[model samples]
Target chain A: MKKKILCVCLISVIYSLVFSACTKDVDFNQINDFEVSPVVESSLIFLNEPANKFYNNGVELTTFQDSVAIKIFKDKFIKDHLVKAELVFETSNSIDRGFNLRVDFLTDTNTLQHTFNFSVPASPTNSVLIYNYTEVFEGNELLSLLATEKLLFTLNLQPGEAINESTLGSIQLKSKGIFYLNIDNTL
Target chain B: MKKYLGFILYLACVIGFSQNKQILYGFSEIPQSLLQNPGGKVDNNWYFGIPLFSHIHANAGASGVSTYDLFADDGVDFNSKLESIVYDLKPNDFFTINQQHEIFSGGFAYGPSYNKNEYISFGLYQELDAIVYFPKDYAVLVYEGNQNNINRPFSLDHLNGVAELISVLHVGYNKKVNERFTFGVRGKIYSSIINLRSLNNNGTFITKPGDNNVYDHIFDLDLSLETSGLVNLTEKTDFEPNDLTKQILLGGNLGLGVDLGFTHQIDKQWYLDGSLLDIGFIRHSKNIESYELKGDYIFEGINPFFPEVGSGQTADEYWTEIEEEFEDLFTIDTVKTKYTTLRPIKLNASINYAFGEKLDKECDCTSEDSEYLNRVGLQLYAIKRPRLPQVALTAYYYRRLFNGLNIKATYTLDSYSFSNIGLGMSAQLGGLNFYIMADNFLEYNNIYDAQSVSLQLGFNYIFN
Candidate 1:
């Protein structure tokens, strides 16, 4: 009787073990892929003029100067406040360009101002540069002020270049703003 | 929401009954015997029965994590570096980030029979979870040009919670033929309910300039900038506080299930058992929303010059434009869903030995009493405390106190899960025999954390 009981227990044990082992093992390999569906909401801006610069007199705008100036304005209902903006430029042909730029906002008048200056790369080929900026409307400052308002800008673009009216081509201001250079033909 | 309220009222009404118990609906087999013998009316036939009849029969319990308890304390508070730059700006200056609100829940299980072949049972369970955090003060700031500008201030103070109720029904049967062979099976049914809710708060404020602190922005800009009076003229206005509102959500699902078990006694002293459970899924209804926003802000104190409109615009018109321009600012069609419970299926198998005489051979006694357990012998079967992998040995010492009463204590260890110690008695009176058992002698497992505990009362009627 003892032997029979032992045999039955042993057989059952072995059978259960074999069955459990034969069953599928838990797969712990994690296969996860993060697909950030590109938000159609975000925008990408491109400059039509690759160089984004001009020449004045016998000098180039790439030369360092005291300051530079430009006019800015909001295009119709497209309100643009200076939330955050930066100027990005790259040097080519091993030419070095050194400069600085300062920014200011005239909230009451709804205009942003640039009173600083900076030099661009003096590379022979056309170099690309960008001024990136952003602004957030706070309180009713925006709702009431911008219900149907236009944002404008006044920049001081100073360089050792030969300043002229046609030196910078048609003021291709990406934003609803104007650009200008103070230079005389007599000089 | 009305239906949910009605159901809650109904539950309150049911629980109001003094006799209403914390009923476990899963294991109905073991308790059947106890319910029948509560007044102890057994006599005669039970005296000739084996003491082993007093073996334990059932247990019910619950176990799981608290999603609400863990998540409720997650409110957010906003802090800004710009505030630090402005020396006059106090720590309370920045607007807050929205609070984190969510609901989570876990489940339970109950077992009613130890000697699987003799019982059937039922169990019921429920859970409620509520957790959310409210941010104090914080807001997002966008930089235009090189200056800091404040956007609309919004810190969501939302509410989210979930409640669940589940009912399970089960039945098991056991029979021994001749002297050794025994077989059994169990059937089950399940049903459940889930409720959840969400709310939102929105506001606006203006930025002010001025600092009374030593490490203010004016100081930092001057030190790093080397330009005196660079921010001497920099100015901002104080914030004007405004309105707050909320929103609500509703949704749920249901399900069905079945389970079967079997046991066999290979010999007079050896037995084997196994079972499968929860083989089904719960279905749910799609979610639906039912509220909208209702307030606005006035910026007079901050901007004394700017005009303020009291109530010319409707919430709809404002929100529509806000959604069109800055859709990310406000969450539209936010949903809170009840997660589906994933019940894992279980299979059980065990071998047991009875300490009595080997009933394999024929008995010579002809007396009616001798023909019963007397022929098989009256030795007690004591339960074993240790668990030996693959093989578990259990015994009970049965003592017959009266003509129809037999008492015994049982100890069992389900190697796959945990062990159980049980105590109970069986009484037989002619055609009606009843047994009652309370498992876990010393509370190795309780109504909460233990592996499993159950009370089983069973009934058996044999035809001559």
Candidate 2:
């Protein structure tokens, strides 16, 4: 009886050890129920005042000299496969003439990397008219721009016709960039 | 948005599921079995738990969605997966988390050896119990905006849960009145170190198309978060673990409780047992704090003419005014008030039939005095909850494989799953006793697919 009891004890211990070791390993794929998309937005406004005037013979507006910086793509996970970037310009013009708007993407040293331009029709009655324009960058161009930590944007507004000093017009430019990410499972 | 995502991840890590240990109920002669049924039969005179190594349990589960439901290898975008969770889940579906850890436990019985009818048993164990029910409505309101579900009222009735860290000191009396009836009653003194509860919340959030604006949102909220032994943490930035540990030992709230149980022999081959455990309440008076929000508000999109640039005011100023007005509408009131919380009472009943050969083959004792070596039984278990009592039914088989080795297998049906199989084993070698048990065995290979899973293991020293 003693020998039989000892054999049963040994068998039970072996069985428990084997059962515990057979459990499956945990992986990222097993817990991939949710995903996150981070979007960063920034806006810049230019007012036609004494410091920044509107010219009559289509003069290039130099008031948009300050560069806006992009800081959301610094994380390695986001910068590795940066998918898309969207730049939107909403202008509220009180002037009576149409104008041309130009935007530039530049480096820290002011080297132009990309440029986009669009035309905004003049307001019908100077009641703060709003015009919206959007530009999207994807694939290779987005990935290349995300390689750098710092981003610079420059904007210029060229009046189509001469304007009186008293006739004031303003442009509001908004930019929003969304980063899409896919994390791979190691196990 | 990033902050919300981080908070969700944090919640996922902290919340766990409740494990109903149906297999461990009346499984063997292990001293811990008495916790489930105070009148359970035991052949040993005394048992000593191995300090922290005794009675460790952990479980986690979801009733509405499993990990596979949200995080499978399917070719779907992350946003679409989240939308399905919000729209596809039923309103009654809930996520439950429960966990218990026994710090130290042991039991001993004493009486006249000649009188086999009466005995007195005493034991002390420190335990931590926590359970939280997921608020599905709140999750939907937070994840998906009210734009899609226009005019639909989202209720806050699902936000209910309780957590407690306490130690129990108990003494029980077991008496055999006759050849067919045995009864037991245990008196318990509970010393609770920490307690937190949120229940009976009533509120609604609705949004409808507005006449003057794009959308009009309405809120009617009445909710509170109450706590004890945690008010000091909010006042102090730095605290030592030793101080907190000392407080947990004796400086917290107190309460009383009792457990009643009985065992009856129907004949030479059948038996019945029933128990009601933890019928008690704790008075939370020490450092109590309650944060409540009760109010109603309506917001039609911010006035388009506010902070007019035409009047020389900036858009930033307009946004600041909106923020201030919103804060004024919903203000949280912090008060110090005493409250009471009842324990989640549990009930168990079982009927068994004994038939296999007795382990003590040489003993010439009658059927009434000698114990059977094998048994088959069915058990029913239920625990009180905020809305309703949760229940489970189980059928089990028990066998003695050898002189000191016993094993049990169980099949259970509960809210989480209809096919939950469990296994338990208790072995004794010399004076050392050890036991291990686990439930939902079919999901062991792919745990992520399972809605509920639990495991418990412990060690003790016993002598007959």
Candidate 3:
């Protein structure tokens, strides 16, 4: 009877071990649809420069001395990635004026540069007018600009023939950029 | 970005390969096998585990893609490889890591007339399990940005997973009521040291061309993250090893569970067995913290004309206003709440045919004629998950090589791999027993391409 009991016990133990060992079946492809939160956002402000220059007929507003140079440090989104930069130009004018706006991007030693030009329409009333221009920087152009720490933007506004001395308007050229950044959370 | 990628690579190195241990299933007469099914036909008078050296198991795996698929030196640039991974991945792909160790476990049985026909056993063990499914939609949106997938809503339902670490103390009872039937039941007390879970999340992200601006981005999110004992660690600047050790032992949360198993012998050759394990829940109340994000927000780009530029407003002030507007749109609520988490329950069933000569008796026992030297069997296993139950089927052969040696081999079919092969060996020297088991043997040579791999080994001293 003792021998029979021991044999049963041994068999029971072995069978149970077999069962436990065989039961762990993991399917890596069994999961679908997961969550990620808070996408990254990166922005660079260029010409939030304060200026009160009144423009007359054929008068040009130069931003050389009043131009702002902002330092953009290296970040995960700013390195080796394409940036969709949307530049917005804001001007507060008191009278109807046809103005020419010229923006220049100056890099290392002020040698490397890129330029963008826009024509602003005269407003019927004295109010702040906003103009938006979007450009995508990728490949060599993006890499070259990202390599430099400091970015300088020179804004020049020329009042067109629509404005005269009596209908003069004060223009403050403000430019800011918005870039959407991707945050990698694979970790 | 490099640091994040490096961390993922490091995780793969530490916990990336794992497979089911089909080889050890019914390989030999080891004492620990009783943990799998208390009603199994094997029983010893007493057994002592070799402290921390006994019963160490570790496994890690990825489902849809392997490391080589992304990082191999195939001349293709890194960007293309990443693009393929993000775009070509299936919705069901996932990554998981699991580990269990017997800190110190030993069990003894007492029964009628020393036959141990009806017996009681007990032991203790610690376990850690973690799993995270790959969110393909979110990956693509983050990798390429919403510029390409504009107007297409990306669902956030895929974000769900759990990570837990706990210690279990259990006591079991086995009874032989008739000539052909044996039944066992185990009651367990689970002391949970850490728990982190995020499940049932729902949200969507969409971007469309704006009428007033270049693009309009919208986010509809409802998500929550819950934690227990480890919540305090988030406030700490640095973590000390000793602090974690204390939590793992008896820090905070607790729960109860049970295991049931039975074996029925058919005539002289056939046997049937079934078991259900870890049917329980953990009540998390200590140091509890839950964070929830539940709202919708739309951003139509920024206006440089805001505050009228030279109206005595600094750039910092302008940007701060934008930040405040965003904060008000999608606010995160943090609260302390007690919650309960159910354990991932497991079920197993098997059938066995015993044959061949009676094995040599290593100890002085009364019933020597009842031992079988060889056996063949088929087993089915399943574990409950948040989405569905994971299942696997296995076929195995067990043989006693000699008086003190035994071996088992198995072939398994499961979700991760179709050709999973396993092997297990057990050797008894005097009264000391040592066993080692591994699965997915074919993938060991080229692990970078294999989806899963696992290993388990242990030592114990048993007496008849």
Candidate 4:
């Protein structure tokens, strides 16, 4: 009886030893290096303007400027995690006039923080001609973008073409921004 | 996402669950078997368990992934593996744990005639039960973002889980009705220490091409997260550390429950038994706190400022108005109303055919020849869960080595794995009874690879 009891105890001890080695070689500290980079896209601008809107009482307008309030940079989480951003501007011109477009980031008080300019060439036909432009923000530019609270868009008519109140067709601009974020839990 | 790793690991490793007590369900030699099936056979006329050491049980299981799948020191990059896991997440995947510690237990028989006697048993135990189903859509939205998932709605329905800690005080009555059938019932009183429930949520967030802008984001939400006994834990008073212990000892939100079971003898060799446990509910009235959010909104980019009807209102003014509207539409409301929670009910049934040399070679005409040294049977177990019922089926073989020793082995098939093999042993030495049982013994060599594991052991004193 004593021998049988001791055998049972010995088997239980051995089983406990096996249960202790339940896990294989695992690096729990690997969580320290874990990071997630998620890309988020949002609409930025959409403009569908008839040529008549570009004229003030039959006078051709050269400088068409507008500003939209943007408060994303005000968020500390967004400012810290955002690694880079790409602004995609797609333009369809049927106005027979080329235009230089300037997009700027402004502080809450309207102070200019960063600026990027591109050109939309004339369609040269009755049909709409589409042009694509992409601006990537990183490093100093990314930092500048994160310090602003507004978007200022300036569209200037080029010297080659002119439009009046009776002008036909329209100038269309559609844009979006794709933001890349690298979030670290430790931070 | 990285923050979920620690909690998930705790559920998969530190905690345990034993809804499928295949080895202990019909092990009549062990007194605790009565907890699983009250009508379970009893070998002793009376039994008493050692305090704290009577019955210690724990079982842990995860349906989809194991700890080694994420933390193994393989050549794969950790971030890449995490991304793959998030991509493969399923709503049906879940991790559950059930752990119990016995305080004191004892049972006795009483009657004028030995053949017509009935048994009464009682015990008190503290328990912790938790289950968390993988929220696949929520994880995907946070991991990969909605940029690549246009028009796809991220479901809040996947966010369903509950965890509770409580104490159970129970008394059971077992009676053999004639020679063919035995019926038993156990009444339970529950004292809740802590509870958290997040279930039956409905909401969705979708992104699509906007009529005016490049994209529009829409939100439709109806969600609630309820909790109890947490506020009592955080607030420090003169009671201090003793509060937790007090709650564990029945000084907390109380509830009532019952367990019903029966055993039938079909013939000399065939027998059947079944049990229904925890058919009760708990009313959480004290320290109750809950939060609910219900609203819907659509967001397209700020409309371009047109001077046609402007009262000289700046674009900033318009943006502020939209921001305030968004905030008003998504406000979270806190509720302090009391609520009720139904205990996770469990069902167990088995049919066994006994054949081999009988322990009692000579039986009188009035005695039922039930002493078979060998028995083989198939057992079915199921537990109610938030999303779906969890089920496990096991085939087992039992052998009584001698008058004082018994052993049982089992093979089980469940959602976790098909290779679950278990073993149990009980020994009676000079009126002292001891037993040890464990499932997934086949994975003992590579435990980290196993998706689920369970264990139960106890020591008791008996008198015939």
Candidate 5:
């Protein structure tokens, strides 16, 4: 009888030991502090205009402008996550003419919310002419940029000697946005 | 969202686990062992499992990560830990769960009294199996961004997974051919309620230098996702409560499979036994929905085509054209495509040696019979997976404490850990029989650190 009781007790003890499980200290609330920052790079705009385009029949054209829909900036998710942004412009001129460029961020109703301007120097002696500009938006500027739904770019010819269709050089432009975004999803 | 989370948890509890029942294999004293090796020697003439109380099994395992690694309250920054883990876990890392419960089971010995060496067993069970492999490159791309990794191609092929909830009804035949060998074959009919698979996918997203722009983004995608009977799982879908039950019973997406096993007595003292299980496939033909996106496209950021000078697309025109092209390139086509899936087959083989005084299991006290009270053996187990086969080796010691009680202890080495220890017990109190087994017992003290764990229990009645 004693042996039977001992065996039964041993079996019970073994079963209890095997089934009992303990969890260590774990803080699931830490997810509130989880954050990720990803830097996505993409090409934005490219243009190469010959000097003849600067000629409207016989007179030299002074300014040309165009606009594109900025679909991402107005997104609610993007607006909530975007903390800062930077736009980079790289321009080169083989022609004897320099150009001034103005970028305007507009709302759906064509209301101008933000704007920046930069100038490219002319290569009079046919030397390499390059202009690099970076515009950073933060604090109130970032808010203005996030409210934007459209972007209008205007190019004006700087004061320089310019000819008509016989000119043999071109003005090139390459621009991209380097948006520095800090995203928080913990809430 | 809360309702969806609750439904997912309910499904997991009712369906998932590790399908490998190592300790229960070859433990012939327990009637459930016959399910593992149908050709196993039978100690009783008849048996019946206690309805819903019979055979409950559940297991959750991961190859490279543990709960403590991510959630331990060790005063470390969560983002820092996540970043490190993202870099540490490889594409081969995976998480898997398998679960099964027997609804009913029974077996009976039949034949003329002159030679009663034939037996038949049948049962119905519900099983849930799920596996997901880590997509390491995708994680890195999302976490750290593409600005620094200029040349690396993020592979979408790393994303592979499958989950299924199925009910299986099976009947087995065991025959004792002569005195040296006993072999058995079981045929199964499977009915699946829910299934989702995104396996064997391929694609890559890369960012590189370009002649026209600062960077060119390229997407080479050939991805497809297939699902069956999951349409009503979301809260957005209105479904009757009994619809799920009807689908489980009458959902004609059925399959067939077979299990083969045998035991060979190499002169009593030494023995050999093995089993091959789940060699079958299921044809998903009803209520099937699948999406495929197969295309290769590159983006150089809307080229203005200035080569034609002023005779080129304006900025707005270029943007709109790019948008239209993207819409055409990434159009995901949803189709009612039928497909077939092979079950993850399992192989279990063991070589055992027995010694010590015989435990007269038949109670005949015949001097000619030799059934040892002690046994020591080595078992090899493997299960096919999407990426590779999971394999394990186990060494065990078994002993019969009394005529009605038995104990088995095992040490296993697998991808999880080398120190996995398991224990099982089967006790017969008169006509009522009960058994319980568990693996990774060493981790019971602190389960958060364990990569894998399993438990099984059952109850039955035997008539000898």
Candidate 6:
């Protein structure tokens, strides 16, 4: 019985020793100091196509503005050509709804001595364009925040006019962008 | 008697070191102050948290080995400190300490949609985790010397199997229970595995002239002491018993969980965001009879290692009684006590600020109502440290062009125990958003490392 007890005691001692070594002492100060660095700066540019809609009144005020679509209606006084032109236009979706006129071709060359007749579309009615006489088309269309009105009536010549294609080579309309909008009146 | 009592006391202390908290997805460890926040419109909430499922994360089953040395590495000082705290024991006893633990931990959360009066939102969320540990070793002692000069050193080694897994999921909803708070939750699933073996060294025996104990046992060739005319001997052998307590068994487990989040906008520029994650349970779906294994083991001359061998002669009659007892101790009829319970939950919170012109208006001077609703500019989000209740800072910058291409850079500091860092990216187009992030870019480090690399992926959606 004594021998048996001694063997058991020996086993117990070994077990106890294992437990003793398991303990560890920790000192918070000695660990290496670590800091999170800032994220590397990278640049990216994304463009969002504007929602499809037209300006308040589709036409622009100035001829210098690009969206002007002018069509010449048939006049009995002129032969082989439609001389009396009634401007039928449509503007982009924008609140400004205006256009400008720069009569360059009219002064540079003359095809016939004909009187020019122009009339504004009815307000809040069937008018496809709105001309804002006050706002002007600034330089660098990409940088300028052109009011939607300028994009509406800025057209210069008829689509099939031979000189219209060459003289007015390009028609461009641009508007400033808007992203996330949270408007709280109380705040 | 006193020593035995003291040993019991030590065991009690070790088991009580930390209250084991099971881990599941979507549970938050964040304090009550942040969790109770009411979500609102125009709020993008963020948070920081830590894993509490140390047991499941360190489980020995998945790794196929015990992590007996994980915390016992050379650099740590827990050894010295632990010695001062435990009861006294001899050197041989130290050999048996199973320095391994089981672990199963994960984290997750999603926010309410960003619109007031209108409760429709496409929130953000994710979850991932793993566990590993070492196996335990058991040894038996033998006697050779008569009443004196008896000595033994630990000589046993073993390997334990281990396993780990992680998953993330979320959905959309509209409806705020209150004007200041919007409550939301997410669902997740996880899985894991474990296998192990115990080895003994003094199994062979040889006849050598000895002064006492005239009888020769199977391991007599194994010298207990050279001076005493005894030779130390060992033979290549393997053991796989069928006893519930001693058997080398493997098991697979799975569970379900949820994540909850709340946000409070303290006036656009400043906001409080808190989230709770991983609340769930694991059930052992399989039975114990499912554990089927097959292996080969070779034994030297006369298998005297097991009692009831040929009576007083050479290897002739095989012993069946001893082997039966072994199986009884190692195998279990049912796996009723095998599956673990609930997993640990974590809490997260963050405060963010935006740079540049703050668009808080309904209409601009140009009669433009939508101009104030752009997602351009830079924002900085600061998070608290991990492990300890401290704070860490992170930054994110966003810019967009006329085209649909959007670019951004974001940095985050992980938990406080070690050095941890992470980065994230996201692109948004016509209601389709995609995101990716790499955490712990420096290199992977467990929670024990003061610095490490961790990664996460994200996605978002918007409805018209």
The most accurate candidate by TM-score is 5
DockQ of 1: 0.02
Q: Report the number of the highest-lDDT candidate.
A: 4
lDDT (tens digit, per residue) of candidate 6 on B1-464: 99998954543332110111111111111111112122323222322112221211111111111122233355745433333222222211111111212222222234344433323222212122322112122112211111121222222222221122222222323235555555555555533222111112232222222221221212211111011000111121332233211211222345666656665545544545555555664443433112322222222111221123445432112323333433443343321234444444544555544334434336533342322212222222221111112123344444332223233334433222122233333334555444333333333322233222222222333222
Between 4 and 5, whose lDDT is larger?
Answer: 4
> Which parts of model 5 are misplaced by more than 4 Å?
A1-6, A49-59, A165-169, A183-187, B1-17, B234-238, B250-252, B303-313, B359-366
How well does candidate 3 match the true structure, expressed as C-alpha RMSD? 10.6
- What lDDT is reached at residue B62 by model 3? 76
> Every model's DockQ, to 2 decimals?
0.02, 0.09, 0.07, 0.50, 0.66, 0.01
RMSD of each: 22.8, 9.8, 10.6, 6.1, 6.9, 43.9
Q: How big is the positional error of residue A123 in model 4, measured in Å on the Cα after superposition?
A: 4.7
What's the lDDT for all of these models? 0.29, 0.67, 0.66, 0.83, 0.82, 0.27
Estimated TM-score for each candidate: 0.31, 0.69, 0.72, 0.89, 0.92, 0.32
Q: Please tell me which model should have the higher TM-score, number 1 or number 2.
A: 2
User: Candidate 5 residues A1-73, lDDT tens each?
Assistant: 7658877887987878875677789988888888888776777777767788888779998887888787888
Question: Number of the top candidate by DockQ?
Answer: 5
Q: Is the docking of candidate 5 incorrect, acceptable, medium or high quality?
A: medium
- DockQ, computed on Cα atoms, for candidate 5: 0.66
Segments in model 2 whose C-alpha atoms lie over 4 Å from true places:
A1-14, A21-26, A29-33, A36-187, B1-19, B68-83, B86-88, B232-234, B302-325, B359-370
Q: Which ten residues in a row are the worst by lDDT in model 2 chain B?
A: B301-310
**Which of the predicted structures, 3 or 6, would earn the higher DockQ when compared with the native?**
3
lDDT of 1 by residue, B235-264 (tens): 213312120000011112445555554445
Report fnat for all candidates as fractions from 0 to 1.
0.00, 0.08, 0.00, 0.62, 0.74, 0.01
Per-residue lDDT, model 6, residue B15, is: 19
Task: Please give the lDDT score at residue A74 for candidate 2.
Answer: 59
lDDT of 2 by residue, B1-464 (tens): 99998954543333222546776788646777777777766567777778877777777777767776666556666467766776676544556655566666666666567655665566666666665666777766555435346788888776877777787777777777777887888888887877888886888888765543434567788888898877667675666777666665666688889998888989988999999999998888988888898878765533222223356444445445544666765788888889988888888999999886554445654454556777999988878766666677788988776667888888877666767888888889898988888887766666677888777888888877
